[model samples]
Target: MTTVPRSLDEIIASADALADRFEAYEPADADRDSVDPTTALWLAASRRAAAERDLAAAVVEARRAGVPWKVVGELVGTSGEAARQRYGRHAAR
Candidate 1:
């Protein structure tokens, strides 16, 4: 939850935690039969927020290790410029 993780290990740990939390919820058969739209929306939004946070943390770790933007972009399936534009400012702060 800090601006950036202090190390690659820390980033990985945080990501794992987020993923675990995101996956922890599962509706029972009865609950699934009558799903609450608000609850469903909250779950979806929470997962997305966790994913975005994890990605930003990973980007910071990569940049700290001197990984080039091109490599980062390739890994994430984006152009170097696009990746930088999206994550660079956050890393800078």
Candidate 2:
């Protein structure tokens, strides 16, 4: 699989910049209709994808640290079998 072109630090900086912009935003009445539905959906979907990747990576780290799958499942809000099925391959040696 391909990796992100940006370094982790650069990616974090970009996220921080986005957060700053969002915090500074003050929408006008006219701006209410400015958001495109497709863009909004794409943004949410993209963020969800990123979150999933982060979760998977964390699972790998936890497994490497000798954390049990049962605990991982609880933390991820699922059963041990479910968590194993989902992220076990990534954590496999």
lDDT of each: 0.90, 0.93
Candidate 1 to truth, TM:
0.63
Which candidate number maximizes TM-score? 2
RMSD of each: 15.9, 12.3
Q: Write the per-residue lDDT of candidate 2 for residues 45-67, one digit (tens) a residue.
A: 99999999999999999999999
The residue-level lDDT of candidate 1 at 81 comes to 89
Residue by residue across 4-91, what tens digits does model 1's lDDT show? Answer: 7789999999899889988997877997677699988998999999999999999999999999999989988999989999999867
Q: How does model 2 fare in lDDT? A: 0.93
**Pairs clashing within candidate 2:** none
The TM-score, computed over Cα atoms with residue i paired to residue i, of candidate 2 is: 0.65
